[model samples]
Target: MFDLFKEKLADAEQTVAFGSRLSGACESPVCIYLHGDLGAGKTTLTRGFIQGLGHKGNVKSPTYTLVEPYELADWQVYHFDLYRLGDPEELEFMGIRDYFSDTSHCLVEWPERGEGVLPPPDIDLTLSYAGEQRVIELQANTEAGLRVLNKL
Candidate 1:
C-alpha cells in the first residue's frame, strides 16, 4: 500500500527536526529520494538525518563528489547527489548496486538525473518554497516505505 504525509516547516530548524523524526522511524534498509530546488533545505534535512542516525560530524552535500559514505554504528548510510551527473551510465562505473545492500540506507538528491541507473526509492520526498517558509510532501511507494510512514 502507498501512503503519503505532508507538513509545513516554519524554518530550516524545523526541517532538520522533521528529518530527525523520520530517522527514528526508519529501521530497515530503504531508499529515499529527495526532490527540491536549490536552497530548498534538502541538504539541511539530510544533515539532521545523518546526525540523528548518530554521526557527530559534518553532513556536507555530495555535489562535487557525487556520493558521501557515512558509516554509523548500526547503519551504513550513503548520501548521493546526482545533480552534477552528465550521464546516468556513470552510476554503473561507480557500482551503484553495491550501495543498495540489505544493510545500507541510501538518500538520493536529484534522483531524476540518475533515472534508469538507480534503484527505485521506497520513499519520495519533495520540498518546495512556500513564501518565507517551506512545504514538504512525502510519499511511500513500497511496503518498507509504508512501514516507515506508519511509524511516523
Candidate 2:
C-alpha cells in the first residue's frame, strides 16, 4: 500500500508532524531506505525524524563521513549518506555491521551504493519534487514497516 504527503514547508516545525508520525511507530533496530533525486526533501524528512527522537542539534547528511550517529534517551539513530562511496564493499571495511547493533534505528540515503551490504529495509520512503511542492511516498517492506505506515 502507498500514501502520499504533499506540501512545502518553509521550516522544520511544519515538517515535524510527519517526522513524529514516523517516530511514533518506531521499534528497535529499524532500517528505512530513503530514495530521492537531488534537492528532494530526504534530508529534511530525516531531520524531522531526528527531532522526533529528541535530538535538538542540527541534522546534516553524512556525505563525506558516510555515517552520523545520534544517541537519545530512548533510541539510537544512524543517518547514512553513501553519495561519496565508490563501492559497497567499502562499507564492509568501515565495520558497518558493528554500527547496526540491536538497539538502533537506521536511515540510509543512496542505498543503491551499498546494496549488498545493507540490511533489508523495514520501511522505504521516496521523495520527489512535485512542482513547487514536495511529495513523499512511503511503503512498508516488512511487518514493522506496515505497522509504522498504519500509524501514519
Candidate 3:
C-alpha cells in the first residue's frame, strides 16, 4: 500500500523549493531514498531540505565522506551519498545502524549501492532530467511516508 506524487521542476530553484516543501512534512524519524543520475539535482534538493530544517551552513554532498551529519535545533539529519561506496558491507563497518535512530531523519543518495546494508526507506524520490528541466517522483512506502505525501 503506497502513494505516489509527481511534479515537474522548471529549474534548480524549483527543485530546491520542492525539497524545502518536503522538509516541512517530515517531523519524525524517516528514511528517504533519493535516486538520480550524476548532476540530477540530488544534492540541490538535499541542500534545500537541510536548510529548511534550520541548518545555517552549507549542505554539500558527502561523496567522499559517505555521510554528513547536521544537528539541528530539534532534529538530527543525516545526508548520505553512497555513490562512491565500494561495498555495501562498508556501511556495516561504519556503524550504519547508529545513523538511523528515533530522533534522526536520513536522506540517502544512491541507495541502491547500499541495498543490503541500509535500512528500508519510508519514501523513495527519483529525479530525472527533462531536457533543461527536471521531473521528480515521490513514492511513499510506509504510513509515515504516506502522511508526508498527504501533507504535500
TM-score of each: 0.98, 0.89, 0.98
Q: Candidate 2 on 66-97: residue-level lDDT in tens?
A: 99999988888999999899999999999988
lDDT scores in order = 0.94, 0.81, 0.94
The TM-score obtained by model 3 is 0.98
Tens-digit lDDT track for model 3 on 76-134? 99999999999999999999999999999999999999998999999999999999999
Which stretches of candidate 3 lie above 4 Å from their native place?
A: none
Candidate 2 at residue 52, lDDT?
88
Candidate 1 clashing pairs?
none
CA shift at 122, candidate 2, in angstroms? 0.8
Q: Write the per-residue lDDT of candidate 1 for residues 53-99, one digit (tens) a residue.
A: 99999999999999999999999999999999999999999999999
Mind sharing the TM-score for model 2? Answer: 0.89
For model 1, the stretches where C-alpha displacement exceeds 4 angstroms are none
